[model samples]
Target: MKKLRVGSVLLAGIVAAGAAWAHGGATGIVKERMDAMSDIGGQMKAVGRMLRAGSYDPALVSSAGATIAGHAGKTLVDLFPEGSLEAPTEASPAIWTDRAKFRAYSDELQEAARAMKQLADRGADMQEVAGAFASLGGTCKTCHEAFRIKK
Candidate 1:
């Protein structure tokens, strides 16, 4: 019975290690997309801080908005070509399977970012800026919920 227990424990350890490796480090296109998404997240956080602080820097907002928009639309969808889901990717297979829906989300992201940038360019007041920022955040949440796999 003791030998049997030891064998079961060893088997469990091996299974757990393999499961962990199933989500291990990505390379190639997967790595590139991860890096790009990280930059977008960082910019979003920076702009979010400015919004929350009520500092209202239109120039800074415009720059960050541009950065986010640059990653939006086709630029984003192109990053995940068919079968690009190497290891360590939290990207859902649904992205490729439901390609059109993913494209729509990407479009929404681009439009929201562009609108926010436009607001900044026009020197909108803080309330208007906040609204635009919120819209951008919503768009991100929508895409992430649908396309980013929970890890």
Candidate 2:
């Protein structure tokens, strides 16, 4: 379980790094989504750092989760208009071709973040909160594998 959790966190870190890299030279809506993704990555890194340092701050974790939730779901979907694949966008065309699946992934991410926020807000144990964080990271990895284009 510990190994699995560590792998999940590493996968999310890679995906977030890719997202940050893809934002370079992006413009318009493409830039918007990239910027949002970068923000999410920043939040993930912060939480990951706290977790690694054994500094379990429930309030900070909850706030990070809430911020991720706000940027996910419909907001995420709206950022990707059909054929908006401008230069530097790491969004795969599969997003438009498989719209429903893309939306489902976005919704899943939002749900996972919300669950994490709830767990943190309730003062869950470190293991419980970390599990929620791992679950959220897994969702991000899965979605990126399916919908993101590697640069």
Candidate 3:
């Protein structure tokens, strides 16, 4: 009986290990996305502070806004799909479990990004673009509050 129990335990460990390996894991991809997102976050914050300080050149805002919209709209959601947040993901599990709400915030961010880019591309007066900028910032804040874990 003792030998049989030991064999059973070893068999269970082997099966668990196989299951884990079959999943293919989330090590490098998660790290890469996290770094990419962190870099974009830094860029977003820098642009916000620069604009708020009344020191940003309009051209810089245009370029940076394009850069931000590009990544935020594309890469952000690509990194947070249902199974994509398995491990090493700073994303909250709520992203998948409460998928509708997660997706709503993601869509909001994408829309804000598109709007920001359109406003920037139009070469609108900075004052006229202020509200759009605020909307863009607000979208990011709303999503962060709901889905992203604070580091």
Candidate 4:
């Protein structure tokens, strides 16, 4: 329980940090991707809040996981085309240069989210769900570190 709380806090901090980036000037595909990412972050925050509050609702977890899976993988990769880096966009050129790696990260996120959904659907315990959430957050952190430009 302690570990879960700590992990939730860390993930919340990461999501909050990303939220600090200004998306007001983003347009077109950049804005679309940003909006998608914001949705994902919102789900993560919602789940984290529930976990921290010890209100582990499997239904909510499953729904959130499904939402994340829907937005990830190919859906995420498609948002980045060649040289679509408009101002206020945080995507790194490495996303295109290391396309395979970026795709791999997207796939990982999708897989992690799917796993979480499966666990929730099976009515898994809080510890198990929290672990899956932590894995999901780790994937997001890894991808951001590799492909996002901090401002």
Give a tens-digit lDDT track for model 4, residues 1-151. 4345446567667556545555898899999999999989888888888887787899999999999999999999999998989988989999999999999999999999999999999989888998898899889999999999987
lDDT of all predictions: 0.76, 0.84, 0.59, 0.89
- Models sorted by TM-score, best on top: 4, 2, 1, 3
Candidate 3 vs candidate 4, TM-score winner: 4
Give residue 75's lDDT in candidate 4 (0 to 100).
Answer: 95
Ranking by lDDT: 4, 2, 1, 3
> Over the stretch 31-107, how does candidate 3's per-residue lDDT look in tens digits?
66666655555555555555555553566657656766666654666766567665545577777788778667767
Total clashes in model 3, counting residue pairs 3 or more apart in sequence or in different chains: 0
The residue pairs that clash in candidate 4, if any, are none
How does candidate 4 score on lDDT? 0.89
- My TM-score estimates for the predictions, one after another, are 0.82, 0.89, 0.67, 0.92
How far residue 34's Cα lies from its native spot in candidate 2, in Å, is: 0.4
Off by over 4 Å in 2: 1-22
Q: How well is each residue in 1-151 modelled by candidate 2, as lDDT tens digits?
A: 2322445456456455644464667889988998898888888888877777676799988999999999999999999999998888888999988999999999999999999999999888767887888888888888889999888
lDDT of 1 by residue, 79-122 (tens): 99997777779899999899999999999988988898899999
| Highest TM-score against the true fold, candidate | 4
Return the lDDT, model 4, position 15. 56
The Cα error of candidate 4 at residue 53, in Å, is 0.5
Worst lDDT window (10 residues) for model 1? Answer: 1-10
lDDT of 3 at 10: 32
Clashes of each: 0, 0, 0, 0
